[model samples]
Target: MGVIKVLTGNYSASEGAALCRPDLIAAYPITPQSSVVEYLAGKVHNGVLDSNLVQVESEHSAMSVVEGAAYAGGRVFTATSAQGLALMYEPYFRMATLRLPMVMAIATREMTSPETIWSGQQDAMSVRDAGWIQMFCDDNQEITDMVIQAYKIAEDEGVLIPVNVCYDGFYSSHLTTGVDLPLQEEVDAFLPPVHFNHATLDPDHPISLDPMTPGNLLMKYRRSHLEAMKRVPEVVDRIDKEFGDKFGRYYGGMISEYRIEDAEIVIITVGGMTGAGMDAVDAARENGIKAGLVKLRFTRPFPAARVAKALEGKKAFAVIDRSVCFGWSCGPMYMETKASLADAADQYCHFSAIGGLGGADISTDMIYSTIQKLEDNKETKTELETQWYITE
Candidate 1:
């Protein structure tokens, strides 16, 4: 059975890893992400989790160790943050393209320039095209659950791609919250053991990995990776259904919609800020506004179809992103959402970007302001525009 406890988010992440029962864990500490490693370390030290806990010297070594373990036919896991993730970039990119099925928890923090260590999506965003299945989370519970689900999705036949389960630093990692820990038996039944076709150092089936590929062979591997990623949504839904049946918490596949039915305005968001956005929608509803929210938990394989369907008849939509696509006319999330809603242009669906970078606090007032802009546009505006919210 799953262990039940009032614990910090870091503990939940560790518990998730324990429940998955990884065969190997290699991690290096960085602020915000260190607690997750610490929790797993305790389990290893106490003999609760029988796994190879490698104390690597740096994030790069940490990822490299896990990559080696995974290539050796072992189920492996790891965690890191901003600079740590950046440091591990070389192996991370290869991990995904090679289809390693390794799972990682990345605590999102800002990239250093002026040298700050606060929370932001800049870390993960930096590797957007790294060929990994990235899933951003909204709360502690989701963080815990995604870790387990990520393993299942990555190891599935259709998608042997690595998965990145990302949650905000300090905001989701350090913050303590009440989260439901799934029953051990229930989770075990839902997730199966990792299967490896050909791994490095497998004496029984010795095979070369990342061999030099020339011409069409290189394109074929990239093609297969794309095909595998395409199957993530189906794999995700199947796992979520099983998770809900066992834990009573259903994360509606890649994106979860709240109060979109019979609504005219829909607010778009991803990660922890989504929770605040949903609450704001509820508050707006109490005042009789036809407002709703859609929290996108997954980003890598963007759910364009579902997004299009959700905004079919909506008059306006606003996408709140924690990261920006500076050269683009709007935030990355806004651009993705706008492209998804392209088919619904006949309904005059307007779009905008709000709140980004460095864990900026997003209040209900901010949500309300966006809704006001949408409602005000209901009567007069018909063109799409990218509006950035700046404090007066």
Candidate 2:
């Protein structure tokens, strides 16, 4: 149905953005995120893509430029990672609160203090509540696919928040794999042009946009934003169905389950760790252990309902997070999953497992070990000590 090519995750991101026919692409080069804008710049220079390309000095200006474009009723895109994301935090927060419809790609990287330029999701997790729709990718193909889907999800009139399609830096970013790039025509048919305008700043049509407001009015806007976020899961489900019907791929909306029907134990995963998690589940099944897997596809809205439902009958579950949550002594996703099941906390045995920080490999062996731990304590019906996967 589409042309297949071996593309690095960054290129896949660029390819997906190009297919959407954005009006503008603004980004500054940074680590693994560099190639995303580079590829788009090349297409623009070669006249392959008819989009305005802005060469910015920093990630802040990059996001600021895209936000301006979106405010003008233009479908826009940008990409950044780690420190760059931190640099753009100001405008980034405003973009979502403004309810601008656009997509940004985050080549997820570890924040530095120990000083490292490597793959990790600490950057993305740090700003989870920044009001943007954030979803992490498990592989290169999902990275590409979600990029296109992001725009459709963002621009929906009911849910006009921006989206961050995040994938691990160095791991999925530099990792090249075969991707079926949808033809421009196919994408055009699937993703309609930007027809709805949030607020278009024009001299002819004057309209107030994001003026400083009193606390009472601001609270109303916040409530409206929260209500809109509650609609994202259902919007994603309807869109995934439409996407699957048009193309042959169906990624389960917020959470994807594997081998969970009759399993007694489940391994919860997010982002790039899902592949190894599934492998560990298979290995555990072969060893006569009933282990299944549930991949948390979208983390921004948190998908608490889908996650709680997935582990409904399971005896035990362990959430493996690539980024750690401070003060909690566990990963952020693991903390959130536990919060989601607060009412039924006594029903299942669960614990937190943190690993794969700063580009460390999350091997199948390490994941299988976690599954074994769950199997050993499936009958305990209480949370266990947090497990940290490390080579040493």
What's the distance in Å from true for residue 360, model 1?
2.3
Q: lDDT (CA) for every model shown?
A: 0.84, 0.92
In candidate 2, how many Å is residue 25 off? Answer: 0.6
Per-prediction TM-score to the true structure, in the order listed: 0.95, 0.98
Tens-digit per-residue lDDT, 186-244, candidate 2? 89999989976445877688788788899999999899999999999999999989988
Model 2 residue 253 lDDT?
Answer: 97
Candidate 2: where are CA atoms >4 Å away? 203-208
Give the C-alpha miss distance for residue 379 in model 1, angstroms.
4.2
Q: Show where candidate 1 strays beyond 4 Å.
A: 1-3, 203-206, 343-349, 379-385
Error of model 1, residue 200, in angstroms: 4.2
* CA shift of 292, model 1, Å: 0.5
Best by TM-score: 2
